[model samples]
Every structure is written in C-alpha cells, then in structure tokens.
Target: MMNHMKGPKGYETEGPRLIFEKKLTKTNIRPDQSRLLMPFKSLIRNDFLRPGIGAILVDQRNVKVGLMLTRWDMKKNSGGGTLNYALTCGSNDIVKGNRLKKDDDISFWSFRCHNVICFALVLPP
Candidate 1:
C-alpha cells in the first residue's frame, strides 16, 4: 500500500522570505563584538514585535549568517548590575554562534577594515 504525508504549504514557504525583507535593517557591524542590545530593542519595538514580524541577522557584508526568532530573557549581573541579554541564533553563522561564545572579551571588527553588515527582520504577511 502507498502512503502520503502532509507537507509545508504556501505561507510556510513564503514566511521566511517576507520576514527577511521587512523586519531588520542592514548594519556595518560584526556579529562577534558588537553590543546589540540597544539596536535589537529598537528593531523589535519598531519592526518585529509588531503584530506579525520576523527577523534575521546578517554579516558585515550583507550576507545572512544567523536568525533571531524569539526574545528569551535579560538578566542583571551582580557585578555593576551589567545587563546580559540572551537571544536565539537559529543559523550556523560561526561568528555569531560558536565564535562569539568562545571568548568572553568583546572584540569589535572595524567596518572599513572588515565588512559592512546588516540584518533583515521582515514583517509577516
């Protein structure tokens, strides 16, 4: 006997595309060293957190590296009450993922010397 299974439909296929186009703006900052809290909050308030929106992180060269789907949590450390924000990186961008986590020190890459990057957070349709 033959069997059939359901699969993704129109919205599912087009969701990522739409989200990528509307949500976030491109930046010239490296993923490994930039402090994205302010920028992220601004993006969420202005773009993603609206009724239906999605966002993805891109590299300095406008190359999509990782995707930020949900806002998890933010904590304050005892040391000077520093704010630590936690985010989910859904993509396999080494710079945004493993590499960023490998070191504790914040190291920023220069845009002129490095690459100009940005993120696209698209609103759902």
Candidate 2:
C-alpha cells in the first residue's frame, strides 16, 4: 500500500523550505508597516499564500508565506511626527501548534536581512 501524495510536495521529514519573516518597521517615524503589511495582507486577501519564495510550496508547518520587499502601500507621514503604529509581533519565531491559539502567535525571521519578516497561520482563510 502506497502512502505518498503527488505533484511536487515535500514531506516534513525532508525539512522545511519555508521560515518566518521579519519586521521592517522604522523607529519613531511611520504610521504603519505598509510594505510589510501590504504583501502580508495581499497574501491573506488572496489564496496565493504558500510556504516558499519560488513557485513550488512545501508541506511543512515550519514554512512561511512571504515578505514585502517594496513599499506598495499608500501611507505617508505629512509631518513625520510620532505616527500611529499598530503592529504586534507576539512571541519569537516559534509556532506551538497546541500551546496557544494560532492567531495569537506571530513568527518572524530574516533570510539574510530582507528588511522584514513574519509567519502565517497554520490554517488558511
């Protein structure tokens, strides 16, 4: 009896091609993390959320979605004064599958300094 899936998928034993993304927020000068949020939001908005940078996604929990490389969001600071920020990166780059609610635990990692990083929920929307 065979027990393997088909069509370009990596098993957990093969390790994770995905990792956590990092935060790209500056200090004392921003309304929100637009660039990072945009791609992250876009990933959530659409179902293109995957676990790798290239086209092929993996099948592992440790994998991540993607990161924002450009400032695609339309957010600007007119005065540059202390802007309104609302980003909460809970916990380190650790996703405990059962210890806590998936939404509450946010993970992030920097792949050779890509500005920002973050992780996605185990479940899809």
Candidate 3:
C-alpha cells in the first residue's frame, strides 16, 4: 500500500511542490545554531528566491513565520565553488514555539501566491 501525506489546507486545488524534507538534527533543533541549513543543490527553482530575501513561511499550525534566504559559497581547491542555502531569522523561534526536538521530521513546500513567494512546513505526526 502506498501512503501519502495530506496536502496543506487551502492548497488542495494546486498544492505547492515539495522543496525539501529534513530530519532535525542537533544543530537544527539547537537554540544556539539559529539556522536551518538546506541541502546543497536543493533549490531547483531560482525564480522564487534570491540571496538575502526575506520569506514568510506558514507552519503546520498556520502561523506565519519570517525567515531569510541566504546564500553561502564554499571555496574549492580546484578554483570552483558550491552554493548552499539556509533559512535564518526565525528558525530559533520555530524550534522553540513548535517544541521541535532532535530527530523530528519536517517537510518544506513552496509555491507562489499572487506574485509573492510562500512556503509551508509540514511536521511529522
């Protein structure tokens, strides 16, 4: 049998695409870190995001949280580099408010609403 997670409310008609999913680690849930590092090359669409852009994401409880899209470059020995993305600003509060802990699973979804970039977080049951 195939199991499918329910789509977010109000998005049944045209649900947002799944951007990425992560299992919270020590650094992710820790208050000191205060940032959620997305996987390298995880961003498939650039039209919706830019470096230093502030994004508002709605959590599972429908609470809108503000976060920043930051780009980090890693220098390589071969004169090349890699780009990485992370969510900052309100990461700590999301961890605290949602009582998220290490090993918790979370899925992030993205969609454009009226020319505005929006995201949604789906927490494990």
| Candidate topping lDDT | 3
Q: Is candidate 2 or candidate 3 better by TM-score?
A: 3
Clashes of each: 11, 8, 0
| Total backbone collisions, model 3 | 0
The TM-score between candidate 1 and the true structure equals 0.28
> lDDT for each of the candidates?
0.30, 0.27, 0.73
lDDT of 3 by residue, 1-82 (tens): 0011233445332336777887888988877888887756765445556778777777766777889989878679999988
Candidate with the larger TM-score of 1 and 2: 1
What tens digits encode model 1's per-residue C-alpha lDDT throughout 1-125? 00001112321111112211122212212454333333333332333232112343533344544334343344457543332222245433533443333323232221110122224322122
Q: Which candidate ranks first by TM-score, i.e. highest?
A: 3
Candidate 2 CA-lDDT value: 0.27
TM-score for every candidate vs. truth?
0.28, 0.22, 0.74
Candidate 2: where are CA atoms >4 Å away? 1-68, 72-78, 81-103, 112-125
Ten contiguous residues with the weakest lDDT in model 1: 1-10
lDDT score of residue 82 within candidate 2: 28
Lowest lDDT block of 10, candidate 2:
1-10
